[model samples]
Target chain A: AVAMPAIAQSMPEVKWRMTSSFPKSLDTIFGAAEVFAKAVSEATDGKFQIQVFAAGELVPGLQALDAVQNGTVEMCHSASYYYVGKDPTYALGTAVPFGLNARMINAWFYHGGGLEVLNEFYKKSGIYMLPGGNTGTQMGGWFRKEIKTVDDIKGLKMRIAGIAGQVLAKLGAVPQQIAGGDIYPALEKGTIDAAEWVGPYDDEKLGFQKVARYYYYPGFWEGCAALNFFFNDAKWNELPPIYRSVLTSAAARANVDMQASYDAKNPGAVKRLVASGAQLRPFPQEVMEACYKAANEIYEEISATNADFKKIYDHMRAFRNDEYLWFQVAEYTYDNFMIRARARG
Target chain B: AVAMPAIAQSMPEVKWRMTSSFPKSLDTIFGAAEVFAKAVSEATDGKFQIQVFAAGELVPGLQALDAVQNGTVEMCHSASYYYVGKDPTYALGTAVPFGLNARMINAWFYHGGGLEVLNEFYKKSGIYMLPGGNTGTQMGGWFRKEIKTVDDIKGLKMRIAGIAGQVLAKLGAVPQQIAGGDIYPALEKGTIDAAEWVGPYDDEKLGFQKVARYYYYPGFWEGCAALNFFFNDAKWNELPPIYRSVLTSAAARANVDMQASYDAKNPGAVKRLVASGAQLRPFPQEVMEACYKAANEIYEEISATNADFKKIYDHMRAFRNDEYLWFQVAEYTYDNFMIRARARG
Candidate 1:
């Protein structure tokens, strides 16, 4: 049925406090706040406003979970997977190696019980959840040297996150949890041999291309990496129905916008990066296979230890399987034909 | 600095005709097409494939002026704005009068501009176009009802395309020409509301939400409008560069996966709309009067003018200067403040 008729509803003047898990330096991601706040205000005709606070303005970027959960801020924009330490299920909310592409992840969230299951998990942390944005398929990692085999990953420190880090750890890569802004310096200063930012567009802007000559590909870990917007459960429930809807809609829009920005900007940026002498390399196939092997093993381990993680992962895997099975025949056949023909032509 | 990606530059094979005026739908817009296509091919390991079509697939939609100007696309996904009558610019796109709601317009395009813009415009004379999708914006048709008095609209159909038919004749409304969407529609749709569309998210989606909407003050011209992909240009650049980008990108994404798709499956679609409807709405007292007045004068003149409605009435006057000037301030003020605040926060 439709929402309450406009006449039947008496809108409320609500003020919201949002704590971001990021500094405002990153506009594409931080742009979410600008769009969301502006949208919330416009939707409410300025009657409802969400005063957004930057990561450090309220708390440490990493502390957004506690702040939002504790109601220090009514909401937050972050990578849920970053909190895998608290609940491995969060990785499914974001992405894990070999997971669905950004588009598939969104579909899963909207159609595959992803939002529902992820929300349930957020409730435990005292918040409500929405997928705000995604970094479409990420690059593997920025490396100091060419990776010839799985052995190349041994003991190398990397500023990485999500399940991919663990997968890398199994392959002997020392994973470090660092923020985006911090990655370049850490890498440039030699604190880490490699790091993985997003694709060419962002990587070039961050100047990762300047320092790292051997950039690897197939960010298998994140075909589509999602950013999450977390609203405190209590605060969320307090929103006027319209306000809630606005937040949801805005988040979804921002989700697409973020990725689109990346796509449009990436092509031009890649052209520039190449012009600037960046050396792009593919992750060794063996390394990819090994990472895949390690990833499954880690997924299994987390599932065994955490029921919540196992529960969601099981569902996600099932859907992936069903989806993959269907794609094999129709889409796969045609896309294969097109790619080859286009090249040949 | 660059991906100079040689490994995966491994272009897959395939050929096909796809006409669209959209970027790859990222999880929201055209994301599904991507997921579907990727699943198919990736599942097979380059065995089969489907190509895509983006705007300018073969030719450009607006060039229906150009297509008839040349001969393009077998099919397309475009909104009326691109052509604007071939001459009046009235046919420029679709959905004038308080325009169509995003959903209803979808109904219309599949049903209205659906056949109108194409057969009525693109395909009718020759080429083909279809209603691919829409994002719901449709503020108070923007000329707004708030005019100080009706006399204000003398000779003003305002650049408003499509529905200008009713108002322009009724008042001095003059329609103008502009395009966005690589000619999928007008990237220029924003300031016209003399209106805009999609939603704040997509408005902001297309970067218009930031420019006007009186913050949603008015814009009855386009309530919910559709976007189409135009096609056929010299047998489509003879099926290469553009045709290639399109067939591959469009078949898999574009209009079919655009804002409409996002609006449809977007879980919190309405939620986000309300959140960012952007203080938008019906025009004020005098403003609408001025629009009516101006729209009529322009309509009368055009009704009697050249075989093709000489001198397309470019923009809504009374409020035109005021609106543009208003935006210069609002945009600058709002943008600078927001940008700075975001930076600080």
Candidate 2:
């Protein structure tokens, strides 16, 4: 049963701290961490609070996973996908090419049992998990020039996240991992020909369109990139059950807020990007098809080698299949009808 | 800005009869309608889907307030507060007197809210509002509770909801209110003790919970009660939108299944209630003394004017003030430190 104590009032207080891998200026991402921490504090009657710190304050921006992994902090709000350098499997936590969308990922985590399976994997990293946010179906990246074919990907240097970088590498692209704050300078001087951040909201905020005119769609690598709160396993275990529930519930709230933030803010940001000479384009069918094929092959390899990864992947795929079947019949039919009507209107 | 389409996964053509006062359960409330409807349909996807009936299905349950208002069909899941007739305002929602329990209401709404509220209000009338679910904090039923030495009155009937009936009567109390299924019986029932329903959750639900519960608190009226969605609100407004966001969000998922319906299945449902039962008890000697005095003078003047009760009440006090202020600080401190620690352990 869910409990909310009111009027008879008085809630317990909690003080906790968290380190985030993004700057405060990135509202959706960093804002999500802040909101989660604040909600936990308030909801628990301030009995549980998580003080959040921006990247570089607690540790180097890119090393957030390590900080939490080693218990350098009580908790760290960071993207697990960033640590593919340590293990390829880490990328699955954030986003991957041809992966699920934001809503789909949430469904998978909460109801589809992804949380249970993923938590099993997170145990190895010595942290417990809660979804902090999601960058709903990100944009491909800001590119200096258009690519009409798979060959165009060769010799291009791009800053991207996770195994999608590995896929790019396989396609003969050089993948660079850079913290968000530093992406622009590198892109400006041709240090990198392309960089994939999140969607229009964050991309516009980072001034990415100003540097790269050709903006691509379907960030294949991050169909729905999700961020997470990595609680030091020991600290998580020590928390009273209520606090833990608060933490989890708070994460769910942040997850919803992050998606809404992007959805709400992106419509305008996208317009601004287009007005500012950013050429928004869908990846050519050939490119998308090739990438999908490559993704499948890569997935097969990972499944064979990693037992845990295989387990989660199999379960996720099965649920997705069922969901797709239902969605195709209902959501698709309704969406199609509405879109057509909307267009006519 | 959050929008969910009205139609969900299509149903296998079937028939169902759902009774609710709400126009198809509007999100939080409608979620329940959808859950029940969908579950039944899904469980027997091809065969049945209990057709939903909104307020006034047989007769405006609020007016027809059910004890099986109009000899309605099968089920009704709503808050107890809507019907304050057989008793009074306190009987309408759940309980008054510092009441609002997630699980207890789940029990009451499903068991008590439905059984007691419907039975108390409609036993002679023969209509019912099953306990499908509850909206957590119903405004103190617009009250008429009064006090002078906390002993000035002993048999004043009221339109009330839930167990608060027992509590209020304990403090010089008769409580009553009609069921949404058989509300007219109650408004017409001189047998009323007092009535108290929901606030906004109240307004949208039994309409009467809003219309009547208002007629007291801080003393004997509902301090906090869950508003319910009694059916027979005219077979529930056709049910398409109700099935999607409105009813699904309300009934099945209102505030995360509330503390009702599912509470019994919960493992430790009763422990916290018992430990906290003491807290649930009436205002202490000093507190009741001051409040009782204030309530009387306020009630007399409000009745005397027959003018704006809200306006007069507004001048008397803030919606949530001094007592609440203390809660944010010290009360929260004690709760977080000792109370919470003990509750969980």
Candidate 3:
């Protein structure tokens, strides 16, 4: 039988309010939500229009989870770890210290049964989550002084977050949680000695290089931070199947897009930072070793206390072990050789 | 103004035939096309149903492109590199020796102007292309004997593809382009000494480890192989805006899904292969160095002769260089340290 031709059909104009944890100025982070909304609107032929609000416009940044759960808004775009105060399992939805990297997370979420576990965890909260955005791997942080040993972190006042901050506290450093906007002034005024944002693209925008000279490598705390799109369960179930597929597809695209934006933009930003006299340095092995040890202790402590944390953490750890072995053989070997070879030329 | 509610509306029923280059037995590769079709159908509320035909069911696998271009079918899912015989530029649409990895390709395609260049390249053929799927990094190949030095490659009859085969030939090996199904028999009978398909998931299905004990890793030629969804230009232009958006979103999801499937499945497959007495190994540095040199020379020769190849090659190389540098700092540093630390524990 011949197929019928597609004809113009007026779609129902559904508008949604989406609260983002980020202010609009950080385009790559906040811009992902806008990209997703645009794609959804265009895909549904204006049937689905989501109005995005910067952090404080609808509710406080960290309170987006509350907004989503209470049905204050139909949806929200925020880092899942921001709601770890409610349940530590929420941190796994985003990232945790020494957890999966971007590729591994993608594998776990889409293929290795991560999304199922996470959605199950979210069932108690009356929300459904989708992978929204990723910032590949973040920089360790911007530091005013080089961190050489475990002792160097002692008594150090730094702006960090979540489990990483807790691990840092174990190392005798003072972990202060500060707002994004406030981090720079604190660093500049010596109220804080170090701070980490995302990577070069977003970091350069925050002008972290202006106050910090020693730029550290690899944010082990957040290997790859994922942002999630939270939908009210009732609102989500009420949507037509087509809209649901579009939501998954659009968010998937946004996830790749945000990280790509960071990857493409960061090179130029890093070069500029270096030209402006910022010194790039790998965190000393001693510091990394110390952090790793502290991170394990914190994980053990949390697992011993929190059933939810233990359940998800155990699954994540197992998957990570397999992922690393495979990657070490296929990915790392290729990348290490290629990078060095490319450098030699 | 408050938004109107979505009501069930009668929709257009469009059916198209999609030819895939891969056989259905290799589910991850061929399964991607089915996945895309299913997503498209469900997203359009059963209005858009695509009938997927495996390789040789309708037309030959490699000729899927011709079927799409000639309008014998409205769409076809195949790797663009399969058309390297038509134009070497086609390799850029898929992969090249040491080209962009899965994440880098996603970054380049979605964010770094790869899709623009590729689609512009495809315009001459009256087809539009979308990123369909990827096989993360591939295993180098399976060999009957261990290859420890550059000289070990000489006089070896191996099945490889694209520029990689050409590079292998330069190293004094006879590069045979054997079909996937024929590789096992050829290897079993010793007509071919070695072959490379994809990674462990697909490789296990092909049962290569039974004949070839040494399974080498990090396929240099295809660091990541991408598959594309080709649409007849006229047919693509005929798609409604919403349908077009759905197509983009669906394809993007498929891209992420395929790689994730490979990453998630390969580890277990590799473990099984090892248990079955297959030895896992990396290609030696001497051999890698030789292949890199030969690959560069071939690229130079191609650029000197083919303008299209040169144009995309130059653009891709520039983008790849920047991508590697950024990835080196953020991605590599993080993964390397984590893998080592995780291993120690």
Candidate 4:
């Protein structure tokens, strides 16, 4: 009887295209798309194949969301914050300055009703989304000179992205939106005084350590950058239930794997970067306080004008507060002890 | 041609029995097995079905690994530390005293060669393992009295599991092994001085707060407990590539989701536990340091005798050290700031 039902529910072959907002050379992020595609194919016995395209093969990197929305490609893997110009709500889908970290966000999305809240907003844009990857906590960026105070940020031309750039703007810095490929040249030519990309592995690949000697910790802007897979609403609905289930599982696999890859690789990369003369520095407490204040101000301003942004922001902040409370009790204490023990050894 | 290949690769009708070393009431842990089963069934179009059995249904919870090894069950969901009596090396597969945290362990398992190393040792027992779930950093336990110093631990009868019990033994505490269902009664009847179960979510369900009023935090012995899916090696090899891929992806989904569920649920449960008269306390630094020292002594003694234990311990400790170097720089600083801000609010 089980065999008969399985035969009746025979799978149909389906092929789709996935465009990523990252170049293939940055395998940790770009490779997530490949990982997703491979899992889908394997699980479906090659019946469901998704061809992955690095940024620019189908369209420019920034235009990936547009491509998925307009049906040029059935889906895309990109950072949700890249589309913040459309609405600040988009930033919540990825990361915002002083927001939830990697673990907190995953918990919120998978168990705390985050996906439902986000999908409800995405519906109007003709897209459906699933978390695809995370970079963990990213480096603040590479800087040519040390910043000792908030005053140092004044008039500084920095290549940053999303609402973080807006937060920095409130503190008198000039934020430039430069593509990843161009950040190196911009920093080298003095076109930008500083640039923030990912952590050590990807940053070292781009050779930011050569031009900028001062490397900062904890990119306050992007605490943990969550990459998402956006699918055309109609196309997503058209899939058989089994195919959808497979894709969801595959995306989850990519989501967890990306962070694991980063965590595994960044340790070696950080050591290499430091050995190559990149000075590791923490942002001054005064500067961090100022940025925290500015970030909150920006959130208040956005909340005053956008209901969608306000709803998600309130929900996430509540969840975040509770998360930190629990973390402080066990996770933080255990980690602090271990870190100290490791340092002593 | 693609359709022809897909049709030819029709999935086989297979049924499996999965025994979990968790009770049905503890949904977060037991629920992971259900999550894995659902994914397998959905991906296989109902052709592949896995029937899940809670602890004591088919065999005792502690015997889950033996069931898989002897082919009494195709697989089992359990913690490797339960089998530490067989080999101290088994503790490394789950969590040992002062082991890696949730994110760190996941990173190590998936990317930092943890699975390869673990499977190598597991092979001798005719078992193959995949990370099934993690509970994040757990609460210390419910204590009938406060533990203010190393002196307080002397002659204390505590119910703890695995290597932690041995570590406590070095500190003059008498450790008792009790099943999940028996811990509450032991604590209530004054048969045990203290009992460490899971975090607030599961502990509350077991009503430990009613018997033990002093709730201590930061389960140092298990920074994170990683549950595992132990499959019979021969049966695992016999599966088609498609089935294997599906199972791998499904297990990953469960692995990520379990922590998410716990993270989302624990915060609320903790508040309720405290509200209901559980006085939360942190283990004093003096006691922590003593336990830490004792744990290392045990490690040294075991490492000298067990080659497998030494090899994995050295590798994991090296990885753990490097991970903390990175985490302290960014992750810790950022979280410390946020926690302070939340407190201020």
TM-score of each: 0.53, 0.53, 0.96, 0.97
Sort candidate 3 into its docking category. medium
Model 4, residue pairs in steric clash: none
Candidate 1 interface RMSD to the true structure:
23.0
Against the true two-chain complex, what DockQ does each candidate achieve? 0.02, 0.02, 0.56, 0.74
Runs with alpha carbons beyond 4 Å of true place in candidate 3: A1-11, B1-11
lDDT, candidate 4, B147-187, per-residue tens: 98898999999999788999899999999988888999999
Which lDDT tens digits does candidate 2 get at residues B61-174?
A: 454245335535544545454453444432434543333233223333332223443444443344433345443323333323333345644676665544445455556666
Candidate 1 CAPRI assessment class: incorrect
> Across residues A1-345, which tens digit of lDDT does each residue of candidate 4 receive?
224334435567788999999899999999899999999999887878999999999898899999999999999999999999999999999999999999999999999998899999999999999999899888999999999999999999999877889888888999998888899888899999999998998999998989998999889877788999999999999888888889899999999999999999999899999999999999998888899999999999999999999999999999999999888899999988888888878
What are the candidates' C-alpha RMSDs?
A: 23.9, 23.2, 3.4, 2.3
Scored against the true structure, residue B289 in model 4 reaches a CA lDDT of 87
Winner by TM-score:
4
lDDT of each residue in B224-243, candidate 1, tens digit only: 35555444544444543422
**What are the runs in model 4 whose C-alpha is more than 4 Å off?**
A1-10, B1-10
Worst 10 residues of 3 chain B by lDDT: B2-11
Interface RMSD in Å per candidate, to 1 decimal?
23.0, 23.6, 2.7, 1.3
Give per-residue CA lDDT, model 3, range A142-254, as digits (tens): 99999988899999998988888988999999989899999999999999999988888888888888898899998988889988999999999987777788788889888
Alpha-carbon runs more than 4 Å astray in model 2: A1-13, B1-345
